[model samples]
Target: MNASELQDIIAWMIDGARSAPTPPQMMAECSERLVRAGLPIWRVGVFVRTLHPEIYGRSFFWTHGGRVETGTVDHKILDSPEFAVSPLAPVFRQGVEVRARFDDPASARFPIVEDLRAEGATDYVAVPLINTDGFVNASTWTTRQPGGFTEEQLSAIRSIAVPLARYIEIVTLRRTASLLLDTYVGNRAGEKILGGQIRRGHADTMDAAIWLSDLRGFTALSDRLPAETVVEILNLYFDCQVSAIRANGGEVLKFMGDGLLAVFPVDDYVGDEAEVCSRVLEAARESRAGVKALQFPNGDDVERFRFGVALHLGRVLYGNIGGGDRLDFTCIGPAVNLAARLEKIASRLGRTVVASERFAGICDGGWSDLGEFPVAGFSRAARVYGLHDEISAAAN
Candidate 1:
């Protein structure tokens, strides 16, 4: 590895590498480029600390013959014993490079070193890639070449470390912003905000299948349980609803106490009315089963939780709305309110799932007319329908 070769690699790190779309793809390409440039690399990885609620960081691993493996480290793993002995532990904590020669028994006594040895790796090196914010990210390079990597090969890899850090930092920052936005707000909303739709009145109207659901007796349940226990119950309840909704192409918008609001956006051109409406109904059924099966080891107040869902299909206004500096990205329309009222009616009728006339008409069979009622905010009585099987189960 000559100075000219190292310079060429650095030039690519600064220019050509950034052309890759994502960090994981960029890492895989970088590894391939290095291998083509005469580096005896086996397994290489890049790990960056990220700002996220459930994840501590993200990782991209590239092996000589394997596909690029992307993974995440959860916050819980930061305190795990496995992470304590990994080479990254020292590199990130001390901002120093760690090298272990597997051929030498006296090398660093990390479990990862032994694992690499078993996998035919003779050398392992973990280097710190410090971001502009002074936060330390990490990268690891391993070689299965006989007697490990030569000093020139190691230095050549290190020569590009600075530019590599800069490139990685840029990509990581973009990813962090996306992860945080997607975590706090839903994906659809995050994309809107990212696309510069941050104004208070900028809105998008779409024909959508609206879903509104709530726990049957959440207030009484909260009153009876400890605050922490109540919150735990709420988490469990939402987990059931969120999973079902996302699985069925529904975007969860907001969680107001025990109530959840989500929508299945229909295609404006081709129109996915039947598809979207059926999916929303399927999601409601799945959510109901999930809540019913919620298990509490104590056999306490949460042994058999019950919930109700109201499905409606109509056009909704989705955008930012608030006063002054603070705003909320939400959906609002007569459709949403009608769904809310149907949810209350579902409670009164002892039905697990109810749907407005429009939603019921889009969906196939299995719905029974629950009759018309004088809805609060409307001029005329609104007709509602309930799932026939659920009504029979209630009677039983």
Candidate 2:
């Protein structure tokens, strides 16, 4: 490619960087521009690290006349042999450019080069991209030109590497923040935080179906099981609750040891109270059934894991709360308190699912009254109800 064409591509990349396009879009555009500049490019790949619990980073791939393809690399992938021998690992770790001429016999050392050679690729070049924070990533390009890349084509690739890295870094950091927020907080809460509802006492009162649940005899189980076994059991227990709640359109807000708090916002109600209540009850029943199906890996004669779920419907203040520097985004109100109290009541009453009078009043299914019970932090006793045999049987 000529210098004028390269300059035009560079200008496009600089403008694209400022526009904040997504990683895949940026890669696809860059690849198309490079090809249009007469570089004989056949394939392009980009990889960047991110802050995530399960994912270590993302990879983008673009082929001539093909749409961009992306894949996530799990954190565990770094330990695998596949990453150890790949060109990306060396480029990232050594912070240098790696060039492989598949046409040369010496390039057979890397299996990826051999694979490219089989695919009619003659040259491969991987460049290390260093972010402002001093972290390293990699971008690679391959060509099928008969004699590989000319001096001008190689220079074009080198010149565009910096701006490409800058644009990718911007998109990557944004994605990393979003993924961390969504993973730690629920999606709805994450959106609120990102939308700038972050000040202390920044809150809104909204009606919701409050859910509180915890394992029965978890303290005893923890004492009896090994530390690792206890952790495994807790993870299994939480999986059940999270799956059920999320499947029913509820957001899990916080986890307090063996207990979890979630809610389904009712918004303006609009005569949908019964529908909301039914969803909460269905989630409660599904969670109960899910936990009951868990099998301990150790085959010890221990009692099966059991749970107590409490459902209540009322207004709650949902927002950031805490000291100046550190804050927790969660819900707090009488409804939340009552749901927690009912969870304990369910355990005491030997019922798997318990509902407060307010929730039962709106529920579409039958419920059996469990009489009034004095609950902590309340002025008067609350009437709690349990699912009727017919409803329970159908749920099971």
lDDT of 2: 0.85
lDDT of each residue in 57-172, candidate 2, tens digit only: 88889999998999988988889998888878888888899889876887777889988888899999998888887789888989999989887888888888888877777777
The stretch of ten residues in a row with the least summed lDDT in candidate 1 is: 295-304
Top candidate, metric TM-score: 2
Pairs in steric clash, model 2 = none
User: RMSD per prediction, one decimal?
Assistant: 2.7, 3.0
Clashes of 1: 0
Question: What would the TM-scores of all predictions be?
Answer: 0.89, 0.92
